[model samples]
Target: MIELLVIPANQSQRRPNWLRVKLPVGKEYASVRGLVDTHKLHTICESGNCPNMGECWGAGTATFMILGNICTRSCSFCAVSTGRPLAVDLDEPNRVANSIKLMSVKHAVITSVDRDDLKDGGSIIWAETIRAVRRESPATTMETLIPDFRGIWDNLYRVCEERPEMISHNIETVRRLTKQVRVQAKYDRSMEALHRISEFGLRTKSGIMLGLGETEPDVIETMQDLANTGVHVLTIGQYLQPSKNHHPVMDWIHPDQFAKYKEIGQQMGFKYVESGPLVRSSYHAEKHLFDQVV
Candidate 1:
């Protein structure tokens, strides 16, 4: 067993000092909270138990979760609920768009649960949500962190047609752990999805979580895989186990190692790499809107 995993389990379930985050506070966070509640909108920040919810919501940026909260696939590392989702809410796109409008979000990040139950894999709603956001807030840039649509290229094409400022699909773990971590998601399909997205000429991005027992070589190979797909941006974050029921954290990667990975990703030709203990898929996401490293 890896030292970080065995040590933490043996010592009791306490996170390292660096992982501590300020409790969600501030007027801006309160305002964003009210708007989400008012619009009955779902955000990955809340659903996925994102550690940076406080910081992101405080800054008035949110990654909206569309379709519904219930996901079809039960990825072991995720906190989102799994089951048959609610009937597709036709009006959800408008509500999300209106909420972004109310918040005056300059760059909106939209995501959804995997609705594999739907024939089109929820791509219709995906495209519609992008259109609605574009129409409601023309100036607001968008980053859609999307599902793989079960490798149905047509569904993927539907989303690309909208051409959000950036489109991201997370290959949540390395290929070796994909079967264990992501249950129903296939590593090859995800790479193909990103490759197809890159072929569309849109700014492409993807994220992966560390600490699932992935080796440095696994991480580097994953980075190379993503880069081969023309992924313009990459996000690397520590994988904090969502609950005791979820997959146990295999290792708590040190910040220095995270920094080293970021440097390696830069050398691998990624336009940008966000790697840190507390980083999540959409953490500081707005900065990835351009191809240039900021």
Candidate 2:
């Protein structure tokens, strides 16, 4: 088993001031919340308990989660539920598209839970969701934070055929901690997935979280590896432990460190880098559509 740098439970509970988030309270936030609830839609903002939920939702943008809220993989760092998901809701695509249309979202981000139980890894729903969104909201641009499809290239290509503006598959953690942090995922497989997405002619993106006991060298190496895969956009963020049963916080990475990583990522040839303590996969996603930095 891999050794972990376990912070004392009591100390891990106290987060630094930089990690604080404003409460989700505003007209836009409420409006977006209502749309999601009414459409029976799922969002990574709510499912992952993202720290930037308030800021993102208040700005009238959200990263919609399709397929279903229940995920098949139980990554130690995620707050999303893992189990036998309910049957694939075929109407999900239409509902997601309609919700996007109602929100008048100029640029939208869509992601989904892993559906390993499905033979095609849920890529069928993935493609349908993109098509539905494009049909219902003709003017909206999109970035899809997709799953690896368990290395099933045909399934991955199915979604790529729809050609969302950008395709993202998060590395989530460094190679060293892949097994512990993301139990069923492989670092090399994720890299290859990103490479394939880039080769498909769409802009590619990936993200990773710090404070999971990853060393600086591990992070820089990971960035270079991503750049080698033709990834144009990268996001770096601090990892906040989701619950007592989840991975413990190894350290509270300082803002300066995140800023430093951003600089390094930019210098390494990533066209855009959104790096900060509160950064998540889809945080400030619209900016990435045109390769803009945050």
Q: Which residue pairs in candidate 1 collide? A: none
TM-scores of the models, in the order given: 0.92, 0.91
Candidates in order have lDDT scores of 0.87, 0.87
Best by TM-score: 1
Question: Global CA lDDT of candidate 2, please?
Answer: 0.87
lDDT tens digits by residue: candidate 2, 1-294: 433333433575688777788788888788888877887766667867777887777765678888888899999998889999999999989988987888777778998999999999999999999999989988888998899989999999999999999899999999999999999999999999999988888889999998888888888899999999999999998888878899988878777888888999989999899998899888888778884422
Which TM-score value belongs to model 2? Answer: 0.91
Over 4 Å off, model 2: 1-12, 25-27, 34-41, 291-294
lDDT of 2 at 112: 90
